[model samples]
Target: MTRHGKNCTAGAVYTYHEKKKDTAASGYGTQNIRLSRDAVKDFDCCCLSLQPCHDPVVTPDGYLYEREAILEYILHQKKEIARQMQAYEKQRGARREEQKELQRAAAQDHVRGFLEKEAAIVSRPLNPFTPKAASAGNGPGAVTRDSLSNATPCAVLRPSGAVVTLECVEKLIRKDMVDPVTGEKLTDRDIIVLQRGGTGFAGSGVKLQAEKSRPVMQA
Candidate 1:
């Protein structure tokens, strides 16, 4: 027997014959025979092709055989599997490479989008109309007492590019349904009060008046 516990030899034979002619009945005789080393190895395979099993596969009953040979012998007895196996392996390799490339491209796109957003935020310009503190001198753009005295109370109209007094806006809204300048529909909701810096336009008096009015306006 081999190390895997398979019988490595042929069975014994028992021969018996009656007395052929004159001798009494002869006792039974036994003959024992053994297989060679190559034959013993071949006996382990289901295919019995007399070759060493390169890609060995074990059966449920603990028998070993070459994988392809046994598959062809049992399943596709007459067909070949070489071309089909090669094609399957090639397709699997191509699919793996395609998936890798797709992942790489997606990563690159994400990184590029993040960089573009950061660049846009970093390069954005500051607002030019933002207010700054004025020096004590009478330079250009400085707020002076003369300018404050000249400043007047006004209300800006929406979509009409018109500036008028708050009292005129209140009277127009009360009398007409549309703006006299642009002919657009007028409502108390469209009025925006304007205030001059360092002037009395945004003082407690205007706040008191606004608090007393309907749809209260802010300066």
Candidate 2:
């Protein structure tokens, strides 16, 4: 007996419909749609509403959008951006404080090390007549060096939220550190040095991409 039926022989060709096609069930898993010539493609739809626009507007980057829908989208976007910026500034200030602490610790360590070395030198016995003359100063080969960093990377001004580089801060030296935009009075302590990574382009990419990356900032 063959596998098809007990009556069928091994050489017999078995060709019969095992399952009938159902209009509802068979077609459920497949779709082949054809758009009419008059149909509007997705590109012609409003970017914000995803519908054919009555009052269309084109953004600077050439995306089509409905006027009212786009305006509302922009308003919400501006609010979201402002909130994100505030959070960023708060986090940035915290990090700035941490960096300042690190630098202060380094400076204290350097001073402590110098003092330890000075104490060791003074405790050692030395000939009293060996080094009083100006010509007896240590030669250039002594090669004394300091490890503390004196250069400021960048500076952030508070109250007005302005950030300036070290070079600009240097120009303000021997004078008042005033806010360039608001012309508000500033002090030396107001110039907080900044430290951050280069993530501006990456952030922009996340903001501009499709649904996959859109929620990063909003989240």
Candidate 3:
């Protein structure tokens, strides 16, 4: 009889334990004997077969997101992009309007300064009865109260042919409270103060106006 849990080294021949009346079926050259359930139960050894893990975690489809959820997410992203685009467009429009207003104010200031200068020069008290003096006062201020013929241009004025710059106009505008839309309010200050011979326009403050605009789209 071969004992269970016995460590054996065989030289040539080996034999397994034969139960009663079973040697006939275990005969011949070599026999592979399978253990009976009763014999396997009688053995005091652990026989644990490792079973393959088959816990199912099946996905809905071939993709991670379902079709409807993916569509909804895409729509939401598009809406967000559209909202951003709309906001950018509004900002661009506002900036353009500001630039146009600035340019317009600058142009108006330049024209007004030129006209004033011309008026002063034409209004100068001429030598009576001289054809040359009469011909000299033939520019834009031929018939204005503050004629250009009597006065020299302001020191800040540029040469006759050069384009008038916006820097001086901007300085003057900041020093005074003026409406940028219309040139009518250029000298709206109640009092003018002189400090070291430089004129300063004095007033309460810049006026505030409220206007309605389209609301920016939210994300």
Q: Quick one: best lDDT, which candidate? A: 2
- How much lDDT does each candidate structure score? 0.57, 0.59, 0.42
The C-alpha TM-scores of every prediction are: 0.24, 0.36, 0.27
True-vs-predicted CA distance for residue 80, candidate 1, Å: 66
Query: Residues 1-219, candidate 1, lDDT per residue (tens digit)?
Result: 565554433435332322232133343444334777755655545445657777888879888778887877867644447668788999999999999999999999999999999888855432222122336432122111121122444555664645555556555544775655668886665666666444445553444233345685799
Residues 1-219, candidate 2: write the lDDT tens digits.
Answer: 446676434436544321223433576544445678655458779876779899999978998989999889889999999999999999999999999999999999999999999888756432121111224342111111111122324455653555455566676531665666567787766666555433445642224344554545553
Candidate 2: which stretches are off by over 4 Å? 1-44, 59-62, 122-219
Q: Hey, what RMSD does candidate 2 come out at? A: 29.9
Error of 1 at 189 (Å): 2.7
After superposition, candidate 3 runs with Cα above 4 Å error: 1-64, 122-219
If both were scored by lDDT, which would come out higher, candidate 1 or candidate 3?
Answer: 1
Error of 1 at 95 (Å): 40
Candidate 2 backbone clash number: 0
Error of 3 at 119 (Å): 2.5
